[model samples]
Target: MQDLLDKIVAEANVTPEQAAKTLDVIKEYIVEKFPMLGGAVENLLGGNN
Candidate 1:
């Protein structure tokens, strides 16, 4: 994820926190639409399923 943050910072000209938040929102959107992926997302987040 550090690589992604670096890319976002360089290409999008955004802070690490902003990039992380954007990624989180996008991931949550996908999870909400495709609940089956909730498991994978939860695993990736290392949080509750």
Candidate 2:
């Protein structure tokens, strides 16, 4: 989400590249740990666009 990315950029004071990587890792963890959710996130993220 753009709002989430904005918040992370401001609060974490990180570069765009770093923020993207961080978000990817966070997403990966969620998918890995919450197998039941499966592609729910991908769908949500896709809807965001």
Candidate 3:
């Protein structure tokens, strides 16, 4: 997910830590909104690793 992190850092003009936190928030929101997709989301996003 380094690619995603790089894109977010460049496009959003945010630090790496901020970008990571943003991703975490988004992942949580998606899982919360669609509980059934939690596994899929974790797989896709790599689960904050």
Models 1 onward score TM values of 0.69, 0.75, 0.91
At residue 9, give the lDDT of candidate 2.
91
Q: How accurate is candidate 2 locally (lDDT)?
A: 0.73
- Best-to-worst TM-score order: 3, 2, 1
Worst 10 residues of 1 by lDDT: 40-49
lDDT of 3: 0.92
Better of 1 and 3 by lDDT: 3
Candidate 3, after superposition: displacement of residue 27 in Å? Answer: 0.2
Name the candidate that leads on lDDT: 3
Our model 3 lands, by Cα RMSD against the true structure, at: 0.9
Query: Pairing residues by index, what is the TM-score of model 1?
Result: 0.69
lDDT tens string, model 1, 1-49?
A: 5676689888998888888787788778978899999888776653421
How many steric overlaps are in each model, in order? 0, 0, 0
Q: Residue 35 in model 1: shift from native, Å?
A: 1.0
Question: What is residue 1's positional error in candidate 2, in angstroms?
Answer: 1.0
Candidate 2 residues lying further than 4 Å off, grouped into runs, are 46-49
Query: Which residues of candidate 3, in runs, are more than 4 Å off?
Result: none
Best by TM-score: 3
